[model samples]
Target: MERTGTTRRRALIGAGAAVTAALSGCSSDEPGARRDAPPSVSAETLLRRRSAALSSALLGRYDAVLAAHPGLAPRLAPLRAQVALHVEALSPTGDRPRPASSPSSSSSSAGAAASPSPSSSASPSAAVPADAGAAVRELASAERSTAAAHTAALTGAPPEYARLLASVAAAGAVHVYLLTKGSR
Candidate 1:
């Protein structure tokens, strides 16, 4: 099936949104968990929780990218595995609530609230990009935003979280470079 620019964009954006929601929701893995629990956890604790969420979101991003570009399977297979590693590293500590985010983080992440495309279900065809460069830009934007969140999480989190953030930041940079080159 032929995918149009708009259709591809919708899918890409949709995938990004899904990842964001998954990451944000990680702090409350248990259903019906209270948003207003006692605030005794250290910044490190909060960071781990938030990082886990971010990790989950990034995984979703990879899933979306793969879905949009089946041809990328061979190239992206290892990257996808790396994202899984991120999730595993963050999983054990991904369920604590964080302090209220600063205004800047909130604004930067506002784009995360949008809806994805409705034209298609999640599948290999969904992975195909109508224009490789445009898809890369969309993916880059999501990675950039997630990386920013990692930076914020690092400021208030522990040294371990900082290390994780550093790694994630490096990955995001790599993703941006690859996407740009791929587009070209």
Candidate 2:
């Protein structure tokens, strides 16, 4: 039997949507599930999930900064790539949805909107203090602070994540130097 092109496409789309819905439902902790249903996952799984979410959030912020300051692109390209690699490596672990009460959740949308698109070539303005340096230092500092959270994420996260955190930390330190020097 020959199916019409529209019918075939609609069938495929319906099947895909059903599969996505099923996966999304299964991924969440069910309300009726026992508090101790074999814990559903090991400590490593929890750690990996949390770490992946944190890493994704941090990288998202950095991507925004790089977007805003075009001049930093040449210098930050490698670090951004590393963050991307880290995000991909940890992506199998899904993001943990932020609770309404979480302080970070409140600012999340604002941060996302504030991130620059990289096409705009905005420089550090004279409005800021002399010691503040260029936008890169500020960006590096943000990465460093987030790296510390990644370190905290390591407490219960997989052992491998510790190494990733270390790499990010080191990269952030290098970013600080490069940004400062570039600003001079």
Which candidate number would show the highest lDDT if scored against the true structure?
A: 1
Report clash pairs, candidate 2. Answer: 67-118
Q: Compared with the true structure, what per-residue lDDT tens digits does model 1 show for residues 103-122?
A: 35442122221112122123
Candidate 2 per-residue lDDT, tens place, 20-79, comes to 899878864677656555646666766666655655665665555665665556666666
* Candidate 2 wrongly placed segments (more than 4 Å): 1-39, 93-134, 181-184
Which numbered prediction scores highest in TM-score against the true structure? Answer: 1
Model 1 pairs whose backbones collide: 14-116, 23-53, 67-126, 67-127, 68-127, 68-128, 69-127
- lDDT of each structure? 0.59, 0.56
Q: Could you tell me the TM-score of candidate 1?
A: 0.53
Off by over 4 Å in 1: 1-42, 93-129, 182-184
Error of 2 at 82 (Å): 1.2
The lDDT, on a scale of 0 to 1, for candidate 2 is 0.56
